[model samples]
Each structure stands twice: as C-alpha cells, then as structure tokens.
Target: MRRLALAAALALSLSPLTAGAASAQTARATASRGLTPAEVGTWITGLGGRVGPVQTENGLTFFTVTNAGLTWAVFFYGCEAGVCGEVQFSAVVPGAGATLDKVNAWNRDNRYLKAFHTAAETPTATVQYDVVVLSGEGVAQLADPLAVWLQLLPKFAGEMGYVAP
Candidate 1:
C-alpha cells in the first residue's frame, strides 16, 4: 500500500499540470516590466488584432483593436510626454438586447473587470490595470486579460443577441 501511494504521488508531481503551473509562475516572475502605449499597440498587433491609428489627447493615449468581431478601445492613462501609469480596455456594447441587468451581473460576478450602461443606451465593458510606468508587469500581465476578453466577446454578443461580424 505504501509503495502504491508513493508511486501515485510521484506520478502526480511529474504530471503536465504541475509543469504548466511552474511555467506560469516563471512567466509571472519575468513579466515585471510594464509597457508603454506604443508597446501595448505592438503587442495587440502581434496578437492578431486589427489595430487602428494611435492618438494622444490630453494625458491619455488611445487606440482601437478590432478582434472577434468587436472593436474595443485601449486607453493608456496618465500618459504625458509618452509614458503611461495605467491601461484600460473597453468595448461599446451593441444596443439591441443589451441591458443594464447584464452589465450589473457582469460587474457582480467578475473580479477584475466591469460593465456599465450609458444614458445614450450604449453598454460598455471595461478592464483596467494599474502599473508602474517603468518597472511594472509588462505585456505578460496583459496577455491573459486580452485573451479572456476575446473569449468573452462572443459570449457577450450572444447575451446581447448581436450577431458577430
């Protein structure tokens, strides 16, 4: 019985799941350096997003990425003279079946993201992250959020009864 238990423990420790966990830890440790607006744009483009021209207004840098049939704006906050302190990802929800309840439910269930409805009957979902201008989590921190957003885009479309382009 002890030998069987020992063998089971060894198999579990050598599993691919354990390797994936280790890899995730390593990625987190290495992605401490944050990104600039331009760098963020580059990363989005690299992720197969259709990126629009970048614009700077006031202290924010803004750009749009069209992916999974949704066009979303990526805003870099506190950007002045080309540096940023935070980033926000937002998408305008289609007005057909989008409701305040859906937004509220999303906000209540989600931990790192939020949804809101505007007076103009537009629903928007956003995810924001604060980062140190120079030495914070860089593209690595953004990769998962972007990926998750992409996955949710289809679900949001379905919930709002909007057809994906």
Candidate 2:
C-alpha cells in the first residue's frame, strides 16, 4: 500500500513537468508559422548581437545586425500586407580587390551563399544568402542558416581582400 502511494505521488509530481514541456513545445510550434522581423531581431539580440532600427525602402524591409565587429543587413522580401516570407543576409565590402575571377571562384566554391561585384564606379564585393522563411520553421531551424552566415562573413571578407567596415 505504501509503495502504491509513493508511486502515485511520484507520478503526480512528474505530470506537471511533462505537461509544462508539452505546453512549451506547442507554443513554439504555434509561433513558428512564419518569420517576423521582431522574432529575428530578438534572435539576433539573443546571440549577443546588436540590431539597428528597422528600416523600409521601396516596399522592402530590412535592418542591420552587428556581431564580431561585422555588420550585415537582413532584408525581407515577398511580403503580403506586412508579413515577409523570405530573408536575405547581405554584406558589402568596399573596393574592387575582389576581381571577377575571385567572385566566380567564391560562388563556385561556396554552398549557401553567392558573391558578386557591383557595377558602381568604385566597385564593391557583395555576398548574400537568401532563405525562405514561410515553411513553418522554428527559431532553431532558422538558426542553421544564420549560423552559416555568421561563420562565413569574416572569411568572405578576408578572401575578397577587403575588410568589413
């Protein structure tokens, strides 16, 4: 009888913990239907980075995030009403030191990013990664691409012969 009572008490104690974990999981699933700028900003901040004020231009929204002394902009696209379905992580390094050959090589070698040279008078090297965020992905799922971007930003700058300003 005593053992049965102990078992019942243990089950009662663990039930709340299991229920709480399930509730948190459900909340995350419900919140992950789409990516939002606020959620992105919060994630960036959570990574010990700084996010600039939100900016909109030509019907597109973006904001700058600074980490490890490198700054990049996250641009939102494919918006309907105010929700965006995609995001592009872009960073530009000044100077034409990254020749067409170098840009081509980077594009050929890199897997989740593209590099290009701008046509401006003072040529610049730009690297970008585009992600579709409308696939009901949670923050952890989206962090994979962001992690890749963060890991490659400095290497891209060094390989392009330009320093991130």
The Cα local distance difference test for each model comes to: 0.70, 0.83
Tens digit per residue, CA lDDT, model 2, 1-165: 999999999999999999999999999755534577877888888989899988998877999998887888999887665567788999987776877788889889988888888767777789999988754665566688998999898888888788655
TM-score of each: 0.65, 0.74
Clashing pairs in 1: 32-136
Instruction: Please write out the lDDT profile of model 1 over residues 44-123, one tens digit for every residue.
Output: 89978999989877756789888867788888875544656667777676665677777677667766556666545465
Candidate 1 differs from the real structure by a C-alpha RMSD in angstroms, to one decimal, of 11.5
Q: Which stretches of candidate 1 lie over 4 Å from their true place?
A: 1-33, 121-137
Per-candidate alpha-carbon RMSD to the true structure:
11.5, 9.3
Judged by whole-model lDDT over C-alpha atoms, candidate 2 comes out at 0.83
Alpha carbon deviation, residue 2, candidate 1 (Å): 67
Error of 1 at 65 (Å): 0.4
